[model samples]
Target: MGNLVGSWRFKEPSTVEECDSTWGSDSESDEPVAEDDSGISDSVSPAESERAPGHSGDTSPQLSDSPESAPKMKRSFYAARDLYKYRHSYPNFKKSRQPNEYRNLRFYLNKIPLVPDGIYIEEILSKWRGDYDKLEHNHTYIQWLFPLREQGLNFYAHELTQDEIKEFQSTREAKRRFLAAYSLMLDFYGIKLLDKSGNVARASNWQERFQHLNESHHNYLRITRILKSLGELGYEAFKAPLVRLFLEESLCHNTLPNMQHSVLEYYVYTIRLPATRRRLLRYARKHYRPAHAFLWGPPLKRRGGGVGPEGGVGAGSSGIRAPAPTPEQQRRGEDSPSSPSASSRIIVSSHNAMMCQDLAGGGHKGYAGLGSSMVGLEGTILMAGAQRDRNEYNEIVPL
Candidate 1:
């Protein structure tokens, strides 16, 4: 018991020098004590000497150097952070009865198993057999969407069976995911955005329809997320509405700038071409970045700016829903930038349009001021507007 340290503290000095200083004693002190990391500081005062009456001050006990007695190093944030989060969830497949929370390091080590994404998803689809009615979990569907899209395969939307489409249409959340998928399609392939008979499907008032679809706040968020994904994927299909969101703040009314930040972040960090980046940056407010900077990097410094190629929203919707916007609606949405506020936006819309037209072989030169940001796009206005009945919001937007 005499060899034991008198007391301990929570203070963890990160360096040897710091540890020495932390444990350093003044010329006259004789007590051994430590400061608590939980905000308490305590060092035995000289008046509280261990010896009674005439005992010598040099009799103080020294800290031992045994393995168990040595001060332990505290955990580092870099190493413990993820483990901390996992521990809280503490995913035990047996206890949770679900694999959703399971995150075995081995799973990460083994890898997703390299294979043709399309072929892999197709094989899964075969067994699933386009029937989502009885499936309680959608993880299989989720696994299929993300990896394939990451590989830049946007046309995967066309592969969905109608019965599978019905499964997504069954609920609002499902529809939102579906919207994300269609947005992926537009990002990679904006050409297949129409049909002749598709024109008249939205015989109802267009503006009203747009409002109704966005009545739910979640739907609005999904819409903006998809638009940002469009820019990230280098597709110009929906740049008009994308521009409108920033042009008229009212378009983003009652919602946080999540969508706005997403669009700006993509433009700032993901857009590579200087001219295209400059074009997008023109619409960005001076302090816009402080609102919600992206995870990619710090807010871009002046000298200029831009951002995306991989990772996206999800699967495209097939013919189960409404058509794209009509030419008239598109022209209205793409009206030439007349106002100062609208000019920068015009460049974006026009540039995106030019891309679509080119990709779909619309037969024309690239947009004059487009540069690389607007590269290879051909269908210009493939998507006009999306539709969903009773505010459920359909994923298959026109374009």
Candidate 2:
């Protein structure tokens, strides 16, 4: 797969001449050398050296070209030791090596193509979080996730450890959050984890679950979080329902202003239809009079205010919150009328919503898609236009 080149230093094996010069005695031997005593023997191993621990004997001689021939010089490194070399550049081989001082290192490296299996290798390695226990080491940590292929389903499974499941099973809130998050993950990434039942059941009914949450005043934040994730995943199907939730102030009226604002924001940034924009602006102005306090005021009616249904504005907020969109509403959003003029208007409105963010200047009172008769309602009349400045306030006339 790759080519590397570098010079290496290796120790030379000792021959009879080297041994006689290095280990000879001053006295001559009375006996002559034996005919078969060629002075060649097997090299001692590290284990054998350990057995004779205290002896100051020299280590085995460096491997030589032949058993009978001595080498030119003694070398420090081994002759057959495997080595590693990082090829900084190719073609100009010698100059690109790390350095001569780092030659003949006892390390090994593997070379792989920058692209493998038609995908960039870097992308595959990106999932490796390295190691958690050893922060300083460079060991790659792998999650036990695998792509499951069965029947007609093919999705990744996020495997959890026993300890993780134990902790998760103990906390009720954790289960709810995990289920909500798992619903999002299943919808977006085609990934799922085993539920409490340890079944591979798909979260097919997220809408109903969140709608039940809509009835609860306490779980509104979780519902909003789920909606936010859906919106980010570009699930355009949730637009009308999110808008419905946004207007259901009574459903989340008991929640904190921050939670309500998040819901409002998630829907506003998501639903891009021109009709939805008009509806949102009208509802925000009438019901949420403290526009400046919530950081959103009523958008001014462009050119003409003949956008919504002909009805009274204040009549709707009868302490009864609106419900999620019906099947018909969802169907309409999927197949709505779009004209060039309407698209241009939507673009303009979107630009305005982005720019007209300074709600602190003043509040603009809006009607809740109703006629002048709504202003006369006992519940909404006093609250109507209450956030509007007193100096320029005037009686709202019915159309």
Candidate 3:
């Protein structure tokens, strides 16, 4: 067994907002930028980040065999690995050298059946791709379907390696299989990934799939894993749109209830492009309310001064209505020093409102456990059985 370090090991971002705002410089490369709606010209070239090794249309300088080029190649690899920052710190800081488990992922990518079922990548995509029931009930498939550099929930599956990542990124067959796996998961989430542009849009059954997502809290972890895996596998181009869509629907449209927190905390930082991440952060800041203050990456500053007397510049003024104070408290008046009714107004979003309705109509039968889980913090839910990283893996040994 061998341990490899330097640039490949996952490092959690110390300050997420600070990291996102400056990770990738706009002048990093001359690659075309995706124009922001607000006409921001800031762009992080794909070559500087997720552009595959042998991908066509790439203008980045190629690595050479010369000793002088070695350092440049190393720097490029390091830049590529900087695509994501884990919310939770890496699993083991004491261990200097982490395990590099690549054989299983390599064999699996090459169409060899590593799992006990003897089912390979082709069969999984062709036969079991659309099987939502099997996907949900069967836990083993996720680790293989979305291989990560870190440890996953499935102990049976192997973690990724630098070599395996290169193979998946550069080789034609492995890249195709990777995209197929991504497409399958996208369909499962009721999203359609466009073939040419790599942009994602809502699938025909988005409503149905979204409703199911609200009903179940377990998939949130899966989503977090998927985002992390995509970042690791050089699919950073695909991550931004999906995350943008999630934020738009959940925060702005209110269509995706119970998803805002997970998306904001677990999904956003996985984006490789700095400009896009900043744009989404700005949007979230603008649309989100005081209820979500705790979730913001940077310290949310008070705009137009603090909450003033006469309920000015407060929750009431910002469209978040506070519950009517008890008659006794009201009679005591706003100036009463003894009044202890300063509890932050609980924002009953449409999802919570629906939960209330379900409660009124004879208990939450189908939506069992969702209401409680939704209210819990991101760390609480993530630490409980959610596989954040695959740090534990069998090291590679030379024969």
Candidate 4:
């Protein structure tokens, strides 16, 4: 089987200068000693480490730097730091038998021949590149192919480490393999990653891809994870174009249909950059419609006597006002602005028809204000009768 590859405050370390000068001192400090990256420090001997309070005096695990049996590791502060710094490159390393993300990564880069499950990385990559059925059905391979900092669902594979991430980024071979994997996944999603221009565009197979997308709800989640992983890795530059393509397909061209509004909301939010997120939100606002009733509201008034999506009073504009009453209409004097208590008159909004229907029943309490406008969920001004829920004593109280 193809194996799916899946700040603690430390005590302040003494500076290298301090460690160099104070090495011969009589005082013994439990804190980790600092050293340059020139292998192990000679200040603390293995005999002293074994005689220390927390040591078991047994031979420590050997990390093979070469084919020959490496030196026995000691349990000291400097030793611990060394172990942490060069954790990834250690030979004969084991962590409960399951391969770490670095091992899986090495497999993919062809550094190692096969994964823990005995499947060759090339064969796994080949299957991933063309096998849509396996890609859709197999859940474990995704974490291995596109590893991220977040924990994955594959229990058989270990979580990614910072050392592993740096290794992947620094390796030329790994980056090349990553781009190939990215291109493959893009093709699977009906997107073509243009090799020459480094841009993304709709593939010729979009119709077939759309059928696959609509057939299962899991595909939506997979797309979300793919986007997140892309952003988490060094491929953030590829996100905006892909997102724009998705928006255009779902909203403008209507080619990719039946995309849930909620899923689109999350998909857009997965973009890491704030400016990119805001720009995409603006794009979505142009084409997207709110499914939530609370999010539905009238157009807001913009500055300079213009209307906006989020309601605001125009410059020098009179506040919420009741309609002008005719001669025959002034008989009841319900909405007459000419009345003595004109501020107390109920000023209804023509655009608040839906809001009126929501607050139609008599159990709600009415809140009357002179020039105050109630802002709805989408920032639209509610110029109609603003309401509040009655308290336990049946009294209207402001929250």
lDDT of every predicted structure (CA atoms): 0.27, 0.26, 0.50, 0.44
TM-score of 3: 0.54
Higher-scoring candidate on lDDT, 2 or 4: 4
For model 2, residues 1-399, the per-residue Cα lDDT tens digits are 133222332233233122121102211222322211111111111111111111010221222233122211111111101000000001121111222221111000012211112222233333322222221121121111110000001111122222233333455644453344333333321223344432332235544433433333323323332333332222334445445544554223532232343344333433333344345545554555322222232222333431222332111111111223467755764475531222232211211111121221222232121222121233243333332322211111100
TM-score of each: 0.22, 0.22, 0.54, 0.52
What is candidate 4's lDDT per residue for 332-351, written digit by digit as tens?
55464544454343433322
Q: Name the top lDDT candidate.
A: 3
Candidate 3's C-alpha runs over 4 A off are: 1-101, 104-110, 114-116, 290-294, 300-399
Model 1 C-alpha lDDT per residue in residues 103-202, reported as the tens digit of each score: 1111122223213232333233334432323222332333233221111223222222222222333445433433344433322211122332111122
lDDT-superior candidate, 1 or 4 = 4
- Residue ranges of candidate 4 with Cα displaced over 4 Å: 1-101, 111-118, 196-198, 260-263, 290-356, 359-399
Give the C-alpha miss distance for residue 52 in model 3, angstroms. 29
* Segments of candidate 1 deviating more than 4 angstroms: 1-258, 266-270, 286-399
Q: How accurate is candidate 2 locally (lDDT)?
A: 0.26
| Ranked candidates, highest TM-score first | 3, 4, 1, 2
Q: Point out the higher-scoring one by lDDT: 2 or 3.
A: 3
lDDT of 3 at 30: 27
Give the per-residue lDDT of model 3 (tens digit) for 326-386. Answer: 6764676466654343352233322232334344453334233333323334323332322
